[model samples]
Target: MLTIKSVSKSFDNLSVLDTIDLHVKKEEFVSIIGPSGCGKSTLLEIVTGLIAPSNGEIYFNEENVTGTTNKLGYMPQKDVLFPWRTVLENVIIPQEIMGIRKKDAEKKARQLVEKFGLSGFEEYYPSALSGGMKQRANFLRTVLTDKRLLALDEPFGKLDALTKREMLKWLTTVRMETKQSFLLITHDIDEAIFLSDRIYVMSSRPGRIVKEVHVKEKHPRSNGFLLSKSFSELKNELLSSLGV
Candidate 1:
């Protein structure tokens, strides 16, 4: 559903991404993992049109979208929720931006919030919610844009280990139910393995795809899968690739 061809980005004379090429199929969840400052987030920005590529082209669902377009839903590192807005308001923010009727947007937002376990909390403000709940609200907000493609840049990086694991499980469940395409950037090996169909390992600087690992695990993956031989083997392989 998305194609990136010979994509590169640089700041002044220093290159961050070099000739990166990738294709993501519809409904596939792909994770990009690498060391810090590897340009994973840069590549995501270019793909989502938040920033222009220094060179090369990006296509979404067959149309060229090298620059900003409405076909993408981006969830950045922080939730960046509007403190003044209630959870329901936050979830429907995108719809407001798109000039959709408030009533219609609120209806859709309520359905999503309830579906994602934020039902009774719709009237709550950001400060009133826990970190996990806030992130859930953020997730709902991003997807409510109704974009066909999702780009997640370390969406759960700030959460504690237990909350992160819980969120990942919830995300996997949502993906299975919705069949949305996701391009996730993460440093956690276990998270990448548990949530992705294919994992792309990138180099340190001037990031490039060094390896692609396929996780053949089934959807709605169980906690038991984390203890399986295949999971350990794949995790070890990723560690080795990163020279850990």
Candidate 2:
């Protein structure tokens, strides 16, 4: 449902991405894993029209959408929630920006808050929520934007290991229910392997697609799947690709 062809980005004399070619099929979860400063987030920014590529084109539903804004939803590395606003208020801000009536937006947000496990905490401030809860709230806000494809940049990077694992499990269920296409930028190979249908391994800056590994494991993957031989092999393969 999304395609990027021969995409390249440069700032003055420094090049960040080169000859990038990638796609995400409808409802497929794809991940880009690489070293820090490898321009993964920059590529996402280009895809979402926050920035323009020096060369190449982006397509959604086979239509040229390069340099277009609001083509998809974006959730950045940080939650960026307003401490002053309650959870429901934060979730509906996107609709408010799009001219949705306050009553209408709240009605929709309330439903999502319940679905996303934020029902009773709708009136709570960000400071009152745990790290995972805050991230879940942020995810709800992103989902309410009504976009088919969501660009996620290290959405769980700040969480502790246990929290991150729990969130990953929750995300798998989210994917199953929502069936929305995702393009994720992450440094965690295990996270990529566990959640992605396909993983793109990128080289260090002037980032290039060094490898594309398909995770053959089916969705609703049990945690036991993580301990299987197949999972170990995939992890080892990805580790080799990253030169770890």
Candidate 3:
């Protein structure tokens, strides 16, 4: 579980996040969505400890984690996979960084690669994989590292609509298998609705939580879930919340 309490971030005179409060329970998948430049990514960076928050606290399982543990796996807007490294090699980078023995790391990486549908492509480089395949590799890398929490900052933002849908469905499968706490930032309302256990809507500029809605849809949702009336209503509400 992760908790952000009264967290705010400012760059000089510009205030971005304003005392934002949110939480993700164990095994929960949560998302934050707002108009562009709403400090969603900034909030994520603060939680990841890439940047210190201007104010307040971040806790993991009830302990203050500010400037602390490396229990977080952050996937940015881009996969940023090493073009030179093969898929197996890319995923093992985390294990390498953690100083785990090569044999142990490869054993875990092999299982994860196969689980993510990249078993045969393990020897292939980034160039050999499609966008969706690359994202899977990216997610697999994150999963390989931080087995606790996944902080994904718009990982699907760069994909085409059809590819994005496919990624979302695949992502749901991935999350179910991993059971990691995921805090995702997405601009796509449909994507948020399709993937989240709960969705938090943020106000623009000096971002603050405007609304939080629990997604009642079941996990591993069917394709028809996206076409349901409940999905449309929630999407409309999110759009209206964003003032789009």
Candidate 4:
């Protein structure tokens, strides 16, 4: 339900994104992957209205929401959970900001805490949680915002490989259950293919969409799919798209 048209960004003559055009359909999961300096995060910042583009428009469900905040739920690379706040407290921050009542917000947050596997950890602080737990708490906080589309910027970057794999599997289940639209920024080809319905490969420097690869594999995809011939082919295709 989100569309970006010819969006470009620049800072003091250093061009970043160049005439980018992309969209996420309702309940669709899409990913953007590219070289390190290709402005993937910048594109997301613009999408989330953290920063305005130098050019072009952003539309949410066909309404122009360019240069506006709160249109999309954003999860940056870091979990950014407050160190002092308990898990339940952190999850309710968005609701508090939105003027939701403390009693009602807490009630909702409690339900999601259980749903997201943070059940008994409600009173625990960020320091006490494992890396995966921290990420789940962070994601739960984002989900509590009740935004239809979520802009995720490498939320699994900090976890160990095995933990990351487990989180991905969990995310697939969550997607099946929630059917929320996701716009993910990830460097992992497998992560993108494992979770995304379509992947956008970007060019370096002034990032532009160079290739769009569609993953026909249906979810919930299993771990064994990672070793399959189709997965290998898809990985190779993405590698080729990145010119690796």
lDDT of each: 0.91, 0.93, 0.90, 0.93
Better of 1 and 2 by lDDT: 2
The residue ranges of model 3 lying beyond 4 angstroms of the native Cα positions read none
Report lDDT (Cα) of residue 168, candidate 2. Answer: 92
Cα lDDT, model 3, residue 211: 96
User: For model 4, which pairs clash?
Assistant: none
lDDT, candidate 2, 1-244, per-residue tens: 9999999999999999999999999999999999999999999999999999999999999999999989899999977899999988998998999999999999988877766878799999999999999999999989989999999999999999999999999999988999899999999988999999999999999999999999999999888988999999999999999899
Residue 12 lDDT (model 3)? 97
Instruction: State TM-scores per candidate.
Output: 0.98, 0.98, 0.97, 0.99
Candidate 2: segments with Cα more than 4 A from true spot: none
Error of 4 at 136 (Å): 0.2
lDDT of 4 by residue, 1-244 (tens): 9999999999998999999999999999999999999999999999999999999999999999999999989999977899989988898999999999989999988877776889999999999999999999989888888999999999998889999999999999988887799999999999999999999999998999999999999889999999999999999999998999
Distance (Å) between predicted and true CA of 121, model 3? 0.7
Candidate 2 differs from the real structure by a C-alpha RMSD in angstroms, to one decimal, of: 0.8
> Model 3: per-residue lDDT, tens digit, 1-244?
8999999999999999999999999999999999889899999989988889999999998999986647689898877899989988898998999999988998988877777879799899999899989998998888888668999998988889999888888889988987888999988888999999999999999999999999999899878998999999998888888887
Q: Which structure is stronger by lDDT: 3 or 4?
A: 4
lDDT: worst 10-residue window of model 4? 108-117
